[model samples]
Target: MQKKVNWGILGLGQIAHKFVADLKLIPNATLHAVASTSGERAQNFAAQYDAVHYYGSYEEMMKCPDIDVVYIASRHPRHHENTLLCLKHKIPVLCEKPFAMNGVEVEEMIAASKSNQTFLMEALWTRFLPTTKKVLELIDDDVIGEITGVKADFGFKAKFDESGRLYNQNEGGGALLDIGIYPIFLALLLLGKPEEIKAIASIGKTNVDETCHMLFKYSNNRIANLHASILNETATEAFIYGTKGVIRINSRFHESTSVTLLLNDKEPKDIFFEFLGFGYRYEAEAVMEYLSKDVIEHPLMPHSFSVDLMELLDRVRKEAGIFYPTYDRV
Candidate 1:
């Protein structure tokens, strides 16, 4: 392999655009290929991202020898198939999060990766952000004392369109599988898998979750309160409280640039991190680092992490009466 890592992108959506921009930020990484169902869209994305190859057929791109790794940003329902395609070609994959429609799909993807001996990791961008790193650092130092609870909420008002992925059950539309995963991941990163989970959700006219709320109980007596919705606007922030102090994330905490520390009664101190492009570069860098080391998975967000996370999503959705297929919608 050359010093430069060649990347191929599937699905020319908004997230793919952001990821391509970050690909340019990494000196040793280059966007070499792109594919979309629409040839025009694929060509346009390739032109904009300086990709050398563009195809309307994902299979064609998978056969391209210039591509070393592929990023799958397709609709949630297609993640399993898209990942399998790359793994079949012995190409590594960095699949965008909500790894698949459910735990079943996630397990299959993991099996494919292991069976093919190819690299695979879910692209949960926030896990590699500067703010998250600092949060983990603070917690490790015990600056926040014994952790007791975590609270997070993410929501927005989206125009109702049942045909769109955001409201289509077949496309894996629902607050819990979409934005809800953010808060759940944050809680898991801090507290591990919960001992007990209670979740409630409001199913919209489209049979998708307009809103979802979850409470998790840990063996250590810690609990996490999380919420996600598309029916209304929310505070969209996160707070972690401990016996000694609290760590507060700014609004839109998942992608926020700053993390504030408020210990006991002391004045709040904010630490800021300025990032290039869309902050997806951090994850891209991590992937490159892992590849350079000949590793099949990233420790920060490994295959097990993706599996565990998907199981949590599965449990929450089942308890809330959500299903993956449109036909299964109640």
Candidate 2:
């Protein structure tokens, strides 16, 4: 029998807790260690999850010989540095969404991973969801005929707490990098990278985007309409239009339970699939399968695709004059 891969978690935030809850669903992976900025928090996480070890600092946890892979769940602004540190330790990494603050940082991490022969991948959990996979298959089969457009939105009202991370500039709090990434990823998956892009956003007092409307033009003459916000809730749904039919995804495009298709002059067809909470386990399973084969990255979410997505985001951010402090580091 193959041995289980030992996993170390960096940052015990709310998302980390959700991921841990899903990690229990996989049999070939084991939670081995946890590192948090606070020793007290680390201890609490370790006790709650029964992690083998806890470290007050990430550097300490990265040095552990037993940890085969590290999951970086730090805040967006800190992802680049946190991932680089794990790469320096020669440990494989599965990082949270948005990859990094910009494309340059993602390139640097990719280079380091290649040089170190360590695996690295973005934890774009939606790409592996069952509904998404089936949708891709239908697109490939031309079930929707020639694809033409995509529409997706992810938005929710934010608490007015100025000190909260969602409203703090230093924390990289914004709709563009947070909820916006989902709509962007959906477009990328179906249309590949866009050839041209334009965006408009509502800037907040904290100098972060509270709402954004984006347009993507693909080389195949297809287009994507994407939107996100931190002020008001959206339908949280998606529609992929093609020449022959349309695919409508349910709320929370990332964790969809079913999809409906309507062909020209034909009745609407409904497709359903069962998935565990939020569909995070699919990504975990993909990682386990690829890691068992010693693959550095999964094809579904390749490093180049990540780089392209980040570059596109960089262009949009520049066009909108929305800059983060980490851009200087690039």
| Predicted structure with the largest lDDT when compared to the true one | 1
lDDT of 1 by residue, 1-330 (tens): 548999999999988988888889889898889999999999999888789999998988887887889999998878889999999888999999889877778888989988998999999999999989988999999999999999999999988887788998778898988899999999999989999999999998778888999999998788999999999889999999999899998888999888889899899999888867888999988888888787789999999999889889988988888776642321
Residue pairs with backbone overlap in model 2: none
Per-prediction TM-score, please? 0.97, 0.97
| Clash pairs detected, candidate 1 | none
Local distance difference test values of all predictions, in order: 0.89, 0.87
Model 1 earns a TM-score of 0.97
What are the per-residue Cα lDDT tens digits for candidate 2 across 1-330?
Answer: 757989899988989999988988888779999999999999999999889999999999977877888889988878889999999888889999889988889999999889888889999998899899899899999998998999999999988788887887677778888888898889988888888889988888888889989999987788999999999988999999999999999887778989999889999988999888657778887877777777778898889988977877777777666667645443
- Report the error of model 1 at residue 40, Å: 1.4
Per-residue lDDT value at 301 in model 1: 96
RMSD of 2: 1.3
- Worst 10-residue lDDT window, candidate 1: 321-330
All-Cα superposition RMSD per candidate: 1.8, 1.3
Which whole-number lDDT from 0 to 100 does residue 84 have in model 1? 95
